[model samples]
Target: MSDTTNHQRIIALEAENAALKARIASLEARLQLNSAPPQSLTHTTPTATPELSAEEYLRYGRQLIMPQIGLPGQLRLKNTRVLIIGIGGLGCPAASYLSSAGVGTLGLLDHDLVELSNLHRQILHTLAYIGRPKVLSAIDRLRAANPNVTYIPHITALDKENALEIIQNYDLVLDCTDHPRVRYLVSDAAVIAGKTVVSASALKTEGQLVVVNKPTSSEEGGRGPCYRCYWPRPPPTESVVSCGEGGVLGPVVGVMGVLQALEAVKIISSGALEGQRAPASANEAAAGSPGTEGPSKPEPASMLFFSSYSPTPFKTLRMKGRRADCISCGTPSDPALKITASTIPDYDNFCGPGPDAVLLDPKDRRTVMEVGEMIGRENVVVVDTRDETQFGITSVGGSRNVPFVLWQRGGKVPEEFWRAVEEEGNSADPQEEGEKGKGTKGKEVVILCRRGNDSQEAAKMVMEDPRARDWKVTDVVGGIGEWARKVGGVVEY
Candidate 1:
């Protein structure tokens, strides 16, 4: 097909997909209200049913009653070994539910501490338990939730030092860390270890989940597709933010985390929802095989992605197999997946923190507006550095109108404009020279102007000193115009 024709086709298909999602949302809401499974599969257990201990029995009572997850399925859950890497927001819910559901043995890895702010939706930590190691706290909380389960906690971040060793021991691996770098690294490690991986992500109010499991050819035994099949590389530096600094609706994560848990359970179980089809809802044939176990529960190497957005809705997309040119996973790296032992790759360097970090300044009044809402509680200050003409649109709600340039004629800055700005904040505190850069190096400053050029340079200039680099330095992503369309804050007219 011609390129234009293909492009048109893609657009049409995406629209169709969007429509289908809307319909799915409607159908799902109805399904919950009706308490229906659409189509329930019946699996008969053998005469000699395996005896589950008291804890296992109580924990899995609900799942076992379902014909699809009867005695055999419960056994499957008991025998399954699922490893959850990084127990942050996404990991917390996935791991919690997995443990509560009796996932037998759960292996967790994370090298961080819990802060009070994490309680907003992290769901794993409480204010009373703040300032404790995350891995340690997670294990304790998980164990208490379901004493029948076994908990294995690795108090270290996954890297070249332990990725292989850690991932190889589990039947499935769940990627819940918020770091894209770690996500990619874990994907490669799972592919190499010949294990099934279910990856999920939640940012702001949006979330994505993917299932990867490549099939072998007729001759050479093959592993499934890795995460690289879709996302090729991380976005440029300065294009990322954290939930700690970027406000997120706590329950938005609640929904995504629950979904992640469901996927993890489904990945390990050999029942209806795990890999099997969800049955025909409206005479629509299932996406995969008849009784086709979805990618969630695959033969060996498998992957699944599911994402949702609040103020919007929930959507699920499943992709199968590995890409040939996946920079991290493919024919060129099969031997890497065949590691005789578990290992962690050098994640920091692989993820990039090199000197050439691209610093983007998406500064604009609109940018300030979008970010103001993001850090609403912090009372972050926005500095307007636009010229007069552009200042007409600047929103002063979250900003202080400190135009860095006062032009006299022909776009030329007035005399001592820089000196005035340098000495302007002094009125607040003349004795404290260091305090002059209140929002610049210490408190919090988001430089904004028209088109993001002047503000970008201004922010960079303020942070030129090594001491100021420790201060939060960020350029609004996508410039002000883009921010205006996404999140509406306030614009000074």
Candidate 2:
């Protein structure tokens, strides 16, 4: 060949070589034999609905017969995983029902030990298990109710450190804890984990129930309003009362807890209606993988309030959906306000200072022993701030009943009521010089109730009143319950 012909032929051969390399690369991609991992196709894998065994059919026949809950609903319940964060009054009843109803996996978490006092409301912890870790005690009782159900007992407290990880493992969470600080933590952690929360609280004869962070629509970026959406800030320290202090009716908490399970069943069943069936493997659901799931379900009522004493019980409140400015569930107003595992705010601070921190002023409080010592002092006056019924049930020997509600009315109560209260305490000590005693006449006022919480709040009210400003006012620390325990059980609880 000539020099020019040979050059052209060389170019053609190089081009052919390039085409062969391109074909080889294409074949490698098709077979996924290259170094890079193959891309997954974007599609949902449908979860199959599980069927009931012969024994399961007979055991759940009553519920299965209901139209709202048939085989499909039962299967959904069997597939759903729930975590109950406290095994106290609310947790006991909630765990009981959820287990019997056949929830696939139930997680019971609590750091507290069972106590004698808990027997009245914490039904899951029995005399046999007293002094044991609450989660262990609760799990024992639950397993007896339904041995087939799997139970996960977390003996440690749920805090920011373990909350997100634990929460992400379950499909739903139950905020059965009594602490206000934990309530906010559970809600925030659930929001971050992309799970829904069912929360219930009971004190005295009243109870409240709410579902938080439920998905409103698959198209919506975030779930519905969270706990902070309505209660953007925690209630004032004095406004909260523990069941231990305030005293709850076991049946009242029982009612709320049972209803909490009902709400969970409803939430889970609604998903089945939308064709979001249970995963074939329990491991997949517990891992919270969207491995095989369908669209989200609308949330139930925003809130429910039940009072055993009310003429009409069980009031449902409608929600206004998610707030545009919600701190946890909304689009952040400030870029720095975003909440993540690392960015969760100090829950204690977000819930505000607790009662213990708020009542640190020396002049504002008296110990139970100090108040008990004042019982017979001629000049010291005791005011029982509980309602007439509670005061009648138990009270200090000589303390006069002045319902806290009358004082909280903020001048709505007649001036004569205060005068009468003061007069009762200042009854004439005939031995004193009339004019001299009258000048420094006001009695040192010590306010007390069942627990110190209400008494502290009442004491602050008394100190703020212009009419009582001259009075040296203080709350009884630990209130009558403490006084009873420390001072020979003089007061009834």
If scored against the real structure, what TM-score would every candidate get? 0.58, 0.75
Q: Which window of ten consecutive residues has the lowest lDDT sum in model 1?
A: 283-292
Candidate 2 C-alpha lDDT tens digits along 1-493: 9986885575455445534543454354334323323222132121222234567777888997887776656766866778999999999999999999888678878888778899998888878766557777777677667865767767678888889999887888999988788888899898888788999999888999988887666325636688888787777554566676567899999998999998888877656222323443444334342223344554443688997898998798886777777778887788677677798777767666664554537777998888877877876778887878888777888787877667666634335346545555446454443332243256687888776766776777667666665668888887777887888646545
Q: Which parts of model 2 have CA positions greater than 4 angstroms off?
A: 1-57, 64-72, 203-205, 272-293, 296-302, 307-312, 355-358, 361-366, 411-421, 430-443, 457-474
Report, for every candidate in turn, its global Cα lDDT versus the true structure: 0.58, 0.72
Winning candidate number (TM-score) = 2
RMSD over all Cα atoms, model 1: 18.0
Number of the predicted model whose lDDT against the real structure is largest = 2
Which regions of candidate 1 are displaced past 4 Å? 1-51, 214-223, 271-312, 318-321, 332-345, 354-458, 461-493
